[model samples]
Target: MPKVTEAYRRKKQLEIAHAAKKVFETKGYTDTSMNDIMLEANIARGTLYSYFDSIEQVFLEVLAIVDNHSFTFIEEVCNMKFVDQLNTLIYKEVVDLLRQPSLVQARAEYFFSLEDTTFFEQRHKRVIEGITNFLQQGVESGEFAPQKDVRSIAHFMLSFVDGLMLNTSQLGETSNFVYDQLEVFHSSLYYLLGVEN
Candidate 1:
């Protein structure tokens, strides 16, 4: 038998995580099990256990994959103007939520099922920090002059977006509802950033 290389291990892990993502998206967090993941990945029980100890661990890996993709997207748009970058990010997020409502449901269910929300809280904090840094960059470059503290604005923006996503997921998009809300959000964002629209 050949020894598994580190690269091989990583590739297998990603394959498994992607498979688990599909299962979670379909069945949600509460209903998904390790057996489901194993079947989805088409791996033996022992093979799956060797890579992941629990369903939560597999879910975390899936989240990591998503975060990596998001970071890569952010890096790709780093050179764009701050306003354009913001618009692109918002558009991508909205489209993703609308297109993958099951993913949104899974994520919400996973977080709600957690007994200790420290992980979710930490992730949320990091997101707010990232947004704050982006807002600060805009200010430093003379593109924005926020009416409030950058961090506060970042937190508020994140909260508002979260609420919008949840509402859109539950209520379903009807009669251009999402676009109308997004238009309002964009207008409010510009006002908060003290930028002319």
Candidate 2:
């Protein structure tokens, strides 16, 4: 048998992950099975099992890929003006949620289905930390004058955005509800940051 190089293994794993992502997006976490992923990847059951022990493991890989992509945006926008960075981040998030409603559904379903929320909690902690650091930079630069602790503000901001996405996913976008709420959210942020709109 030919030795499987590490690079080849990694490439195959990513291919399976990408295929599983599509299955999750279409069927959500609860409905997706190993067979679904196998069919999506066009691989035999043994091949799928070689890379992942279970569906949850594959989903975790997909989430890791997503988290990496998200942080890449943060790095890319690090040099932008403080307000511009925040605006761009929030706009991109909202736009992505709108464009991939199924992705939102899949994520929500997966997290909700988990008996232990440690993974979700840890992920949120990292996101809040990133946001806090970004906000702290604005504070240090005299661009933002947050009335409350930056960490607290960051937590609230994350919660608000998560809630907004959940609601939009469940209730459906109607009468420009997302834009209306987004406008309100932006106004609230300006007030909280003591920045002129």
User: What would the per-residue lDDT of candidate 1 be over residues 27-97, giving only the tens digit for each residue?
Assistant: 98889999999999999999999999999899999988877776677678889999888788777765675
Error of 2 at 107 (Å): 2.5
Model 2 ranges with Cα > 4 A deviation = none
What TM-score should be assigned to candidate 1? Answer: 0.93
| Residue 58 shift from truth in candidate 2, angstroms | 0.6
Q: For each candidate, what TM-score against the reference?
A: 0.93, 0.92
Candidate 2 residue pairs that clash:
none
Clashing pairs in 1: none
- Compute the lDDT for candidate 1: 0.85
Number of clashing pairs, model 1? 0
Point out where model 1 deviates above 4 Å.
none
- Predictions in order: lDDT: 0.85, 0.86
